[model samples]
Target: MGEERRGISRRGLIGGGAALGVGAAAVGFGAGRATAVETERAGAAAAYSLYGAHQPGIVTPVQDRLHFATFDVTTDSRAALVDMLRAWTDAAARMMHGDGAGPSGPTSGDYDAPPDDTGEAIDLPPSRLTLTFGFGASLFDDRFGLSGKRPAALDPLPHFPGDNLRPERSEGDLCVQACADDPQVAVHAIRNLARIGFGTVGMRWSQLGFGKTSTTTRDEATPRNLFGFKDGTMNVKSDDRDALADHVWVGEDADQPWMAGGSYLVARRITMTIETWDRQSLREQERVVGRTKSEGAPLSGGVERDQPDFERAGREGKPLVDPAAHVRIAHPDHNGGVQMLRRGYNFVDGSSDIGRMDAGLFFLAYVVDPATHFVPVQMRLATLDDMQEYVQHTGSGLFAIPPGVRRGEYVGQGLFSA
Candidate 1:
């Protein structure tokens, strides 16, 4: 094989610097044996991670998945918050594309960069670390945060068919986001973030997004909800990095300070409607998924991977995943798969009469490559998915996330340069 898909490309990979660098880049710590480099930054504290495989991955037993959660912190003062965020990120000088050898540049912050075999402290590799800065809707009105409309690309596109959630624009104080699946990897990245004054973090609430029902695990062949039809039948798998790159990633050349690192961005929205779905019956509901509602087997049957028997349900020779059924609408060809990485949470917006309340999945997906992975999935649903009848995407927006700076740097460094 030319190279393992998971291996980092060496084209721009610089090597050889100092073995003692601390806080260099986050480590891909999957289990025990800490690959830690001590430093003055963020002192020391116990850290924990909740890593699970939703997709395939580099973690042992290799599966594609990501750690999903949301958190926040109130700064003693806005100025103090900004300064803290900046210093945490800019601790090291990121590797430029043209550098002959990857070596530790001058130490600039409270922590030292971690060293690769070359002893060089490198920047977080692309997709290795991602930051998305989203503002609270109210924060935009003030002078401190992004004002008015967001940039063109920092917006959410439809992830599922039958569009209900759409984006609305207004600036707000930003949410500091980061990603790395290994609990240690995630914790390391997070600790570096706190080293700057921005460390006082709190999660108002957060969870992986999908529907309220079904945990959405791979163990089940149906992959749909209790209704038995294929659900989330259209989603991104581990191999989709290239497919979503254009839409979700900030692909800068190595020349940019953070080239190998990802550019920060956002896609956020409020997803609603599980109650309407509950009212349907097993038989009627089966019609929507184009399969039997009891076993979650294809309408035609014969295990999940085998071609589902669509011909039995309709007049023409289509699989039971009816052209109009959510699955049929979402996966018309049977062979085609929709692409989207679903990481969302459930929340309460407010209430209505009868003691009823407004609450549902608050959805978000960061795309480094959108054209292939994100768009096609949404396009298919807009045209065919049966699942659309009960749900609607409600409110949404996009934001560009800046890359991590060496510990002492501010979060806005890349944004200003971009």
Candidate 2:
């Protein structure tokens, strides 16, 4: 029931500003325009939010992990809304309260059973695991009764590959994404997904919000989708301000103690198979991610975050991307360390009883150390990359987002009661 704490803080919009809000009102918010009147006002303004590197906790909040709650459940009684979504995908104190484990169940730090009204139990709010899910509209649509009536296929977000949009717009009506490792259990799991109805029932409306990032590993394309090459060409390029503080802010002297007004640490996961990935051959999926099925570039070129030159694409030492590629294990450089920061989102949900599912990405990032920046590029994509054989990390979590809570305080004030 505690909704108005407004927004901002994936380390202050990764240091510049696009999503995360109290309505910053830039509306076409930078990216893809150095100018031409900011590319004719970024086309006209609006369309960048597919959720940019989310965070429900900046870097402190966990009894254990995996906390993401996105909803909008309305059940005048579609048989109590499909038994509340099959008791929210097969219950156990609604996933995680019983400590969810996997078989599609098991991951719960306990969060004080029966819809945590700030109960803080069930454990989770540390580095990050599975709870990854995505669904949009069509609760069988008849508005909500589930039969043969379609109207909830809502998803119009597509324009985040170094975006330069603007043809005139400014959206908001539906968008719910919450990631948590503990910013008070990411606001008690988005207010227990709006008290079990799934969230914002009657609608006070306004959803559009993205977040912090940094990714490249877990394969099948960045651990199951949400922008790990959904046209990946080395993302996050704030152009200047140190690439806008490395894709949007978080360095005022990052030492840690829970860093106060936090910034960094926002890992993610979501892999649903993507048209069974059309079983390879786009040149074996561009030689398992070295780049280019007509432009993801790199095999040592000046695209996708450039600087690539891997001794000019292997320098005849036999490497035009294949020493376990995924862009040479996510940029090995041969010199200048590795780098990350790619805010994200891209999802798909299928009507259940086990029918359609097509999935991938809602992933995120923002770092300082996930063991020297996201576990050595996800331990070379889970041991010797190759897009880790068509991907599968399946939903996970970790949040610690606490920064921007001034107007009389309360948005994890002191990172959720310390």
Candidate 3:
């Protein structure tokens, strides 16, 4: 694991100290050459470890772009599915390391044979690419004889109050979450994986997201969602090791041992009523969200990071934070101390017939158990939050993300091992 060897660049080999010394000795170079050398060294440095106790994308630094896809297992053969998983695992490792999908890359020089990689990301850096896989509830439905191995916590999500779900976009048998700083790099990873999965698994649904809606580190400025509110202000950051272990990571003695280091993933496509929200007054909007739009501070407020004083009163002894406010209902203190790692992204999928934007947040959350962490919190939000009137939950999915693989192993090998 010496940084996984994400392909050495030509600049790294030809412009380093030793290489520069040799070049200067052979042919004395000038200022322009020196500038070019420095420029090459200053190029993007983005790479993440592909092998670890848990998957990289969940807790890894939140990338700016996302390409999320879900697929159905078309082949009935268990062996065929396993084989495809192996292929996908290998391809993911190579892609994360900035290499091509297969052994022979795009420039294999064999014109007669098809190229393994699609050639889009040939000269691009890794961009901190992460490919995370998960198993949906349907995957355990007597198909591939995996019914017995399904985790008890992998139950399907219940319908919420303002849900207008589309069956076609809601669920799938398997899911692949690809995130990267560059949009093209994220797309390249998914395209190559889908190409490799042909004949075995076919994509059921997909979503493209840009401008991350949350921040997972203290150094990162809190990002805004479609509603223009600072999102994930109290999120479980990578530095919060204790919070991650307690709220995000699965325990050692869990329902399924194979999923010890893994966590449950919940994906929701919330469509915003943009026209309606646009007409609302600033006071009404702030009251609904329970925070100041400018500073993102709680209405009971001091500053952005100040703990919300829920009991504080304002005019005529009225509660300062609205009882039905989004922040009030979704606060961890009110939800039995339950918190999720939110890494969502804002998305816009064109427009409807009336020209209203078909857009909202593609919410992604990782929790130790959705039953305890997500279900209760969402249940409260769906019923009590005043913000529900301005948004609709159009798509939903739940998956069991397995533990990460070792260098020589596949993604879900532990489950397959007898």
Candidate 4:
């Protein structure tokens, strides 16, 4: 954290970081003692390009782990903030390729000073690591003279029926979503970034997630949530270009030109009442989810991928998929044909105050506009979905994701220059 005492000017450090990041892209290390010691781990890691039409984490195949962090801008200087972002982007590009945070390597850095890289991920593969960044509503404030550049779609999310959101766990000026197959890889990405941002930014809150709750690729089997029902079975997939265009990516028509090709992100930390939910009968659970407990078929009868037939009736002439069921209430058909590209993960943060499991879904979704794709669907779910009783929206954030960056350009370059 004492980056200043490292006997180097901050600007020089940032410049060197960027130069080393670019050069490290094609660098590879030979098998060493660490690899021999950790031979049990995964072999080679799959690396994704850090530069593209859109950020990697949003539509990239959902990873097994996530380390999502939101940060507050501590410095009022726009130059300082920009420099920190450039440093972050450089480090992220290098790390995604499984390289050290700095070219000097973690342990090889100057012995007299703290290491440039954290060294925890030294022996790890990239594991398809991705670092996606975004700007929260608060980041558009007068501090950096960015008020006019604020996108209308970045407006604060409205409160829903039963939200018990905690202030400490809520919004921030910026967010960085790191995901990788290895938990250590994801954790190391955030830790190094936080270290790099030292004085310019302060981490407001962070969430560690394991066991992905949604699938962005159709080939992977659908995953179940803590409630034991298939979550995001009908999620928008990376191959569905039409759906991504219609519901996820911001296009040229966006009110803010700088946001074109970008997307809006909504994160909800839903805490489930694990004990109470576990007590519910099998039939009750099935009814709440509108899907069979075993195969995840719609209550109306079909395989996991079968669309829910809302009009189907049961023996008593009542709808087979309950009118208030989560699947029914939050379906695209019911939400003005809107859908979200969800990439959430399950998390168990030890125990609660009363000794119950402190676990739930860390719900993350990408949409073109939350106004059309998220708010209304969530409103219906909050008010009518039977699953509402078992889960509480405890933490929330809305961020404006910038388009992918080009080499020599930092993330969010458009917003600052526009």
TM-score of each: 0.49, 0.33, 0.90, 0.90
What lDDT tens digits, residue by residue, belong to model 1 across residues 360-399? Answer: 5444455544444456755666566666666556654443
* Per-model CA lDDT versus the true structure: 0.39, 0.37, 0.83, 0.85
Better of 1 and 3 by TM-score: 3
lDDT of 3 by residue, 1-418 (tens): 2223243332233334243233232222231221011111122434555677788798777899999999999988889899999999999887876677887677553556667788788767677788999999899887788888899888888877888999888889999999998898899999999999999999999999998987888997888887788988888887787888899989899878889988999999999987899899989999999998888999997998888999999978989999999999999999999989999999999999998999999999999999999999999999999999998999998999998777799998888788
lDDT of 4 by residue, 1-418 (tens): 3333343322134335353344344422222110011112233345776777677798887889999999999999999999999999999888886777876666554676777888887666678788899999999989999999999988888999999999999999999999999999899999999999999999999999998999988898898888888887999988788898899999998888989989999999999997998999999999999999889999999899999999999999999999988899989888889999999999999996789999999999999999889998998999999899999999999999998777799999999885
What candidate 3 gets wrong by more than 4 Å, as runs, is: 1-43
Q: Clashes in each model (backbone N, CA, C under 3 Å)?
A: 69, 64, 0, 0
How far is 22's C-alpha from truth in model 4 (Å)? 20
Which candidate achieves the best lDDT against the true structure? 4
| Cα misplacement distance, residue 87 of candidate 1 (Å) | 6.3
Quick one: ranking by lDDT, best first?
Answer: 4, 3, 1, 2
Once all C-alphas are superposed, what RMSD does model 3 give against the true structure? 8.0
